[model samples]
Target chain A: MSEQQKRTEIGEIGEFGLIDQISSKFTNKNSSTLKGIGDDAAVFGSGDLLQLLSTDMLLEGVHFDLSYMPLQHLGYKAVAVNVSDIAAMNGLPKQITVSLGLSNRFSVEAIEELYKGIQFACEDYSVDLVGGDTTSSPSGLVISVAVIGEVQKEKVVYRKNAKENDIICVTGDLGGAFLGLQVLEREKAVFKENPEMQPDLEKYDFIVKRQLKPSARMDVIHELGDLGLVPTSMIDISDGLASELFHIAKNSEVGVTIYEDKLPIAKMTYDTAVEFNMDPMTCALNGGEDYELLFTIGQNDFEKIKNHADIATIGYVDKRANGLKMVTKNNNTVALQAQGWKHF
Target chain B: MSEQQKRTEIGEIGEFGLIDQISSKFTNKNSSTLKGIGDDAAVFGSGDLLQLLSTDMLLEGVHFDLSYMPLQHLGYKAVAVNVSDIAAMNGLPKQITVSLGLSNRFSVEAIEELYKGIQFACEDYSVDLVGGDTTSSPSGLVISVAVIGEVQKEKVVYRKNAKENDIICVTGDLGGAFLGLQVLEREKAVFKENPEMQPDLEKYDFIVKRQLKPSARMDVIHELGDLGLVPTSMIDISDGLASELFHIAKNSEVGVTIYEDKLPIAKMTYDTAVEFNMDPMTCALNGGEDYELLFTIGQNDFEKIKNHADIATIGYVDKRANGLKMVTKNNNTVALQAQGWKHF
Candidate 1:
């Protein structure tokens, strides 16, 4: 084949594939590096305790739209997403460094508003704002946040530790953030077509807020610690429930079976999806940006969390031969498909 | 004042002023956070050892010109700059997270080339490529790198620890990287005017390579450890010697006096600046991105490194009343001015 033919577009392999291809070439050389890529966060040993590091970058047009998303909420969501990565490792976030690239169009007051949100998130999560680099971008705004957290050696959880029969649990609700985006987009289109039209967004406030500012499930992480329970495997549901479940199954080398009825969706989200002429169950399965915690625990720990109101038992681990499947309320079993957020 | 009149443009306050305004509002709340802003890197305590964290973001048109800079070297420089931050803190970097936002214009082959450079730097610095986020960009490429390092509690250094009698020291020569950029820009302009003209860059290879692949002075950091010496105050010369010295002076609350003749400049850099009709001394003092170490050692401890070939003692700390001055070769004591890289 010619050299030109050998050049594959990044869109061909997708984001996860690109990450795997890149990270696979790098081998960890330091003994302090307890874990590298292929997890929610990298783990490193600093004496007796383990330290977790995770980073997330958001670009203006790709990850968010400034027209509908306020700068403050953007800043808050950036920190919250990174904190969620730490929470996925069952760690407490302590410090964060936020880097930003702004165009000349951004005023000092605009940045202050963004930082106001960042400060609020920092206070909410109790994470200290440490250091970062601020530079000018040629075009749009860019934000990258790196968070460091601490977890005990015995208590640290990874994505590759699930065993057969482990119960799958997800915290809070799902799909609200995705449905929120839909409402915002619809309103934006209407406003764009006719400037005189005022957006009637009061009804979809909850779902819209979920998209604008989704909080990380650090509270659930704290509650698990208080209950003396550690998840066998855990991950944050940023890329929809099916995609995150696929990550756990792929990493732990196990099959998953989730019941459709057990999936948690807020009433507002379901109603909004119906108003948009979308299936609520499909949104729950494939919509992204929920920022919820999806974890698995041994069956013995089930009794301890079963009585909890926010925790829901969605599924259980199975043999790899069974593959990933979901059972509908009508008792029809079908193969689960992961339709994650595709930026490309 | 009206609310609209109160709005301040970022360019008016400049980058440092904006940073000061933002970071000043944040107070570190975590006990583990030893130090926050106003340094090359933030200091934190992780068990018995102290950890350092630093992050840098590079935007496509702002930080580099893809026409001249290879993706591989851009990747290498990104990691090197962050590693320099760790070295400034007297720490050994163990892990780094690199996040990238790419547009569709880049092919998978382009990304592979970039990662190859990242891998090379990882090997060179003995740092593990830990975790990062990859997403699509709407316009150009953006790269953000975060590094974590460790130093003994007693050995960790800060910018505010210089003494009045401390001897100022610098590693390697300065201004090469800056001149190198000038040459590249000239060539780019020439090529744009006439694509048929083959650019001649072989003569400026030394400065060009310096611009493309600047290495962090990790060797000096290791040698300092071997000599059983710790800098009283230290900072990496990323934003020019004058700017960095001002950082030391402001943070340490001390005046600085340096000899103009003592400044180190490579023959190539000096000659290149002369050819460009720029002052060579000015370039040496104000041209940034040297990636060299600027540190202060107490007077009594200077004897150990005074005779070293790579170590140049350019000045000494003085009383605050003296202010920051540079004694020119003509015996004129002039106040030093910091012309740092301005993006806004």
Candidate 2:
């Protein structure tokens, strides 16, 4: 009856695409809203310093399946992800509030288990669990966490602060979480086929742990602060390396050139990828949920962090005209593309 | 074969019973956490003032039906409900972070409609929209909002602060929102039964509006501030008045004696309740979603607010030995029972 029969699928736009489209339409009108929607955490202009706030929601079935995922690990990951956002802003997280939608399926013991992990994360990050709401949901579990952190005005890092020739650095190895997920899914399928068969997850424990309990890079944030180094641009690798890199490149008005060989991948992760019949390089490029810090630094600061074991130089910022390209191990240049998680 | 197979239904315990069971388990570890998980919001000690942090989550089907609920109203209601928590704390709301989980069913235009309402609430409260996460859900829409507000150390009110002999006061009126919901549900049924019939809702505009687009009691907070009136204890009437009164009684370790005659009700709400064959008195006591301010003031401060057109003195706080009772029109004393929203 109507001419508007066309329906645009969200999967067509992708997560990053949808974010770009939505964020582009809204402009921050409040003076206190220093930054919005573009960075890992939004920065607010507090009277004395910049206050950073970040929020994240994790849903059951989509984000994590409760059958294989422990309630405690889910709680820990929820807090860690929000902390990761604050860390991406180069700020020290001080407080967090967790809101939970608990279905009737969860017992008192289950909730206690969840809060146990939440308390553990609070102790680890030195954040105060200030406030939260717990209510019943009709189905499934929903956990939402909001973290508050503070950074000095001059030290606050944003995605748009990168300059041309700045070196790109990423903390820890990539692709491990993705490979770990693949291993778990494979084991789950096998177990489903034959209930008598047990999942031999012990051998792939490293990658499995990476997927289940990834830590926020607060240590790196503190280290950089102690060393008097501030990142020129920064974002957390929640939506894969290439997607985050594109965010930096687009926001900072620059192009990036990376060496594929320089990308950090753990040996176990690479082995697991091969076992799954997938390319480790592709996994590293496109896998989400890494929760590692990706940042840009000035050339002069490179000498300061060169010897740091946790930090690795993966790329360099380039002029916008140069475009985003990667030099392969065999000395061949290729255009870099990002294919992030498509939950829609 | 195990003894742990005993499954208990959560509906048996009800929402308040479930909350009481859960709240008894968490002991506050942070010295800055003055109050946690007992009132409308939690109170944390900041250097010179108290920081009020509150969070809420709304799930589709459980909290709202999209067939009758507009996306814009959902967003506004989400913010308003969170801000109402701050109002209950006798605090001025400062900032809010909203996290949304949308299925592919939501179009870009739909999401825009939601944000427009959020922006409207932000402007109304002079609060900044600082940070949030936007991601895809598996099935239904999920909205979670975390709000932060501040109050002077001495001015901050808590549910535990009501003392014996304090006068109970309520802002605006009650039972309107719940009556409005009844009207909406009836219309929805009518539409379902006859597809060609346009729902006759003209006579029930006020009540329907109360259900659809309720405003937070920020005006009460501001007026109290201007009058230099710090309530002895405060709570927003999100749940029915009876339930909230019980909360004050339990938390403050005092008994409440509310006058049934003094309970404020709108004429339209009362007439509509009668037309629907619902008890207006029961609706005032146990019907919820009013978003009105229910609070207690010291006896000495009564002169300051006695002439306020919108506020009514309902009753007074009694000793714990007296218990919670309502004085009926026929001079009969009855115990007040709280029938809060039960999701299970």
Candidate 3:
């Protein structure tokens, strides 16, 4: 407790390193806790089924800018992100608890508008808003959401079960959300320079919606269930595709080889990347917050989803010695890197 | 959406009113969600047993001051308060997820110190640390904890089931935690005015510890189970005795009458209240953050706990027409008013 004691800055370790350092100190004490601290959601037992619990905390200024982010969309995004975690485990979300810390600057009507979006997400996802705590904050708004979901024991998927030669697939398009953020930031800067100028956003509507309100790919989960396919490993693309790929590769003890030509990108996302003078491929690889599902399945199961318009088989799992690599459209090989969102 | 629209301040409706306003908009969509929004914890059927879910959020500056409050105790208290909500439903806490938003000011060692307390609480309560999110905050520290517990379907208790003439009981002592806060605040002021002077806290150690490290009454829960005693209604005392009394009265549609002479106050708490020129009785009635269990048992069940040392019978439930009243030592009756913590 002395001032002279050595101090290690949190930024040095970063968020993931900090989590590893803390989670390593404790061990699970309950038999019912099937898995803890390493997956998209914690797994537990409930009779014949397995239950999943996941939580996410979003703070103002850190997660979103209120000047451009609507209160309703923020609320909806909060729920969607938690639901994405549940879907990562191939589980169906059933209940959620939202805790909010509001400063005096907020009005009751504003909070109601926030909850209106929450209610909309609840109805759309068919999950119940069960319990939560409302408290005061000294500065800014903080929203923390915890969701509970369930999956049959046989259908439960984890991030550590990918096998060599497994087909890697990603649902929906990527990089749109990140490009949307670029547009919003650019527009904000322009407005600040001249307050009288009204923003022209009609041309960027698709990418803007992707940033403000991205939906969880529950449809992909349902389709996979109907196709009788269980992914060997799965994760959601919240910290960009490359970072999520790193997670799966590390946990599964396998290497990955993705093809740049096979990566799914919407027209608007590619155009926005060009407009910003950024590489579209880099944006697709590292632009996060798309909330799409990334999974690996047995090669035999590839045919089941190959014809599906929403899913794209972009890569294949390999031996650990191969590491993670990407094959460019111009026949060049490169190492995959992750430049995820770094709040610290 | 207009500048001319009326803006209702959150303070006008208060925390409870805001919760009620928001929760009323959402309806339960899942059959597994047996109960929601009104209880200390939400109840659902996991399988044969009922499951309970609850969450609490604590923000720095609003909930605690790091200038005096230790990081370790804050971590322990965060877990204990959430566990107390589980105990209120007569359930056994099995797992908890703790999400933290830390700023750059907190060092790695400081975070480790905080987790040490979290680990200690997990060991003491026999609950597993499951999964959580660690993100950076723009300012201060934010902690959001979600707990899941289980109870037999028949044994689960709710706040609205108290019958007329039920004996109202409270466990442990009251006002100590509140008085402890007052003592800490006074000492903090003294130290602020004169940095060279050491705080004279030895005499107030008992109450101070009560404030810093209040334990959840899980021992009482186990004892009740062993004695085959199930209270008709139950709740945890977090927002003072009077506010909790109002919840029971309003939910159960019953009245309450308690004797002031029967209120239990620790000697240290009473002396501290007197030292601070505050009424000890008012402290017991309105001072919050006690984290004790409050319940009402049937008359026939009272005999089972009559000889218990920690439990005290303070009052009895009455017809709704009687309203909530307290009889003072002079035998004068007065309507009880709740001045619970107003955070907004």
- Assess each model's interface with DockQ, reporting 2 decimals per model: 0.90, 0.50, 0.92
Q: Write the per-residue lDDT of candidate 2 for residues A1-344, one digit (tens) a residue.
A: 35345556667776666677766655666566788776888877556566677899999888998867888898899999999999999998877878888888887667767888887888888877766777777778999998877788999999998999999999999998888888889889999999899899999999898899989999999899889999999999988999889989999999999999999999999998888889989999889999999999999999989999989999899999898999999999999997777677
- Give lDDT tens digits, candidate 3, residues B1-344: 68638799999999999988888888898888999999999998655688899999999998888887899999999999999999999999999999999998999989988898899999999999998989889998999999999899989999999999999999998998898988888889999999998998899999888888889999999999998999999999999999999999999999999999988899999999999999999999888889999999999998889999999999999999999999999999999998989998
**Mind giving the per-residue lDDT tens digits that candidate 1 earns over B1-344?**
98855778899999999999999899988899999987999998755688899999988898899999999999999999999999999999999999999999999999998998999999999999998988999889999999999999999888999999899999999899999999999999999999998888999999998899999999999999999999999999998999999999999999999999999999999999999999999998999889999999988897899899998999999998889999999999999999989988
The lDDT per prediction is 0.93, 0.86, 0.93
- For model 1, what is the C-alpha lDDT against the true structure? 0.93
Per candidate, the number of residue pairs that clash is 0, 0, 0
Clash pairs (backbone) in predicted model 3:
none
RMSD of 1: 1.1
Lowest summed lDDT over 10 consecutive residues: which window, candidate 3 chain A? A43-52
Please provide, for model 3 over A1-344, each residue's C-alpha lDDT reduced to its tens digit, 9 standing for 90 to 100.
68748799988888889888988999998988999998999999756688899999999998999989999999999999999999999999999999999999999989987888888888888899998999999999999999999899999999999999999999999999999999999999999999998887789999999999989888899889999999999999999999999999999999999999999999999998998999999999999999999999999998899999999999999999999999999989999998888888
- Candidate 3 lands at a TM-score of 0.99
Give chain B TM-scores in order.
0.98, 0.96, 0.98
Index of the highest-DockQ prediction: 3
DockQ, ranked from best to worst: 3, 1, 2
Instruction: Tell me how far the alpha carbon of residue A38 in candidate 1 is from the true structure, in angstroms, after superposition.
Output: 0.8
- What docking grade applies to model 3? high
Candidate 3 overall Cα lDDT vs. reference? Answer: 0.93
